[model samples]
Target: MAARRPARAAAANGEVRTGGSGRSDRRAELLRIAAGLFATRGYKQTTVRDIADEAGILSGSLYHHFSSKEEMLDEILRDFLGRLLERFTAIEEQGRDPKQVLDQLIEHSFATIHETPEAVALYQNESGALSGQPGFAYVDQLGRKIEEIWIRALTAGQKSGVFRDDVDAGMTYRFIRDTVWCAVRWYRPRGRFRHEAVAEQYLRVLYGGLVTE
Candidate 1:
C-alpha cells in the first residue's frame, strides 16, 4: 500500500494541473513548492520564510492562505496521505488476482517514487520521528492501516495457493518494502532506469523467483 507518512509532502505536487491560470492555481503551485522544499529538507527545519523565499513571495503572502508553517505541513501531509489511501483503496477494489494486485501495487510505488521522489524520501526519513507525535497522529494510523493492506494482499495470495505459503507474509512484505522503496535513495527521475522498466524487471524477478522454474 505504501501510504503517505504525515509530513509536508503534498500529493498535490503530482496531481495539481499547474499549466492553467487562477489564484487557486497559484496557491496550488505555492503548496507544491513548499511540499518539495519540506520533503527535501526536514519539515521542522523548513521555515515559512524559506517557503516564501522559494516561491519568490513575502512570508505574509504565504500566510494569506495558510495560517502558519505547521498549518502548511498539516495540509501537505493530509493531502499526500489521503491521496495515497484513495489509490490503495482503488487497487484493493479493482478485480485483480493477488499476484496482479501485488504487481500493480509495486509498479505504482515505483511510479510514485519517480513522480514524488522527495515525498517518498521524506516519508522514509521522518516517519520514525513523526510517529506518536502531536498533530502528526494520522501519520502513525495511516502507516499501520497501509501495512495491514499489504499484509492482507500477501496473506490472501498465500491462502489462495497462488503464492508460496512457506514464507511469512510479514517477512515477505518487509523484503518487498525494503527492496523497492529504498531504491528512491539512488533513483533519479532522469536516471538510467525508468519507473516502469524498473517495475517490470522487479516483477519478473519477484514473481519468477531466483531459482529456475
Candidate 2:
C-alpha cells in the first residue's frame, strides 16, 4: 500500500473528496497518468485528453476530478514536493552529524527517484518556468527549501571539520544535487546497480574526493 498523507492535508487538498464509489481511486489513477504524461511530454505540451486517454476515461470525466490541467499539475507537484520537504525536514531534525544527515538526504532522494520518478523529472524540467506563474509560486519555494536543507548539512559539516572547508558549501551542495538528481536520466532501478549501492558509491566518491588513498 502507498503511504497516506496527514488526513487534514489530504482533505484540504481535495485528495480525499466526497463519499463515493471508486471516485477517489480513479482520481489518484488519473493524477498518476497525468503526472507521467506531463513529466515525459513537458507540462506545456500535454493536454487533458492525453491524460484521459491514458487513464481510459473521457476528457469530460477527468474534469470531474481536477479543474484543469494546471490543477492536476499543481496537485502533482505539491504532492511530490510536500512529501520530499517533509522527509528532508525529518532527516535534518534527527540532528545527526552533518555528514550523516547528508547521507540520509541523498538516500531519501534516490529512493524518491525510484518511487516517484515522474514527479522528480517533472519538477526538474518544468519548475524553472513555473516559478512566477500563478499557482506555482510554491514550486520555487519548495525547490529552495530542499536546497536549504542540503546547504545546512554541508555547511554544518564544514564547520565541524567533518567536511572540507576549502569548498563552498553552497557550490558543493549544487554539485551534489546536480550529480545525484541528474542521474535519473540514466538510472534504471532494476539495472546494473541498486539505489543503495549507487548511493554508497556516490558517497565514497563525494566525501572521499574521488582520489585513491
Candidate 3:
C-alpha cells in the first residue's frame, strides 16, 4: 500500500471528504509515472504531454495537478532526495559504531534502489545537466550532504581501526557509492536476488577483501 499521509477531516458534514485525499493520491500516481519517463527518456526529452498521455489524462488535466513537466521533475527529485537525506542523517546522528551506521546506509541504499529505481535513475541521469539550473540547487546541496555522511562514516571507521587505514576515505566513499548506485541500471526488482541479499553479498566483499589465505 502507498504510505498514508495524515488524514484531513471535512468540516461541513462531519464526514471525511476524501475528495482532496483522492486528488493527492492521483497526483502521487502521476508523479511516479512521470519519474519513470524522465528516467528513461531523459528529463529534457520528455514533455508534459508524454506523461499525461501515459496517465490516460489530457495535458490540461495534467496541468491541474502539475503546472509543467518541470514541476513534476522537481517534485519527484525533491521528495526522493529529501527523504533520503533525512534517513541518512538520522542514521548518522544515532552515533552508533561507524561500521553499524555504514551497514545500515548501504542496506537502505539497496532497498531504495529496489523500491524507487525510477527516482534513483532520474537523479543519476539528470543531476549533471541540472547542476546549475535555477530551482534545482537543492539537488547538489542534498547530494553533497549525503556524500558527507558516508565520508564521515568511513573516516570514523578508519580512525577507530575498523576499516582499513590505507584507503582514502573520500575515494573509498565514491567507490562504494558509485558501485552500489550504479546497480540501478540493471537491477530487476523481481529478479533472482532480493535487495537484502545483494546488499549482504556486496558488504561481504566490501568489508572483507576478496582474498582467501
- The C-alpha TM-scores of every prediction are 0.84, 0.90, 0.90
In candidate 1, where is summed lDDT lowest over 10 consecutive residues? 6-15
- Candidates sorted on TM-score, descending: 2, 3, 1
- Candidate 2 lDDT by residue in tens digits, 21-109: 47767777777888889889989899888998898889898766777787788778888988999889999999669988999999989
- lDDT per residue (tens digit) for residues 69-146 in model 1: 776666666666677777876887793788878888888889988987766777787778888889888888887777
Q: Alpha carbon lDDT of residue 123, candidate 1?
A: 78
| Selected candidate, larger lDDT, 1 vs 3 | 3
The pairs that clash in candidate 3 are: none
Ranking by lDDT: 3, 2, 1
Tens digits of lDDT, candidate 3, 1-213: 011122221121112344666677788899899999999999889998899899998889886666678777777887788889889989889867999999999999999999999999999999999999987787888899899999999999999998889979999999999999999998999999999999999999997779987
lDDT of each: 0.78, 0.82, 0.85
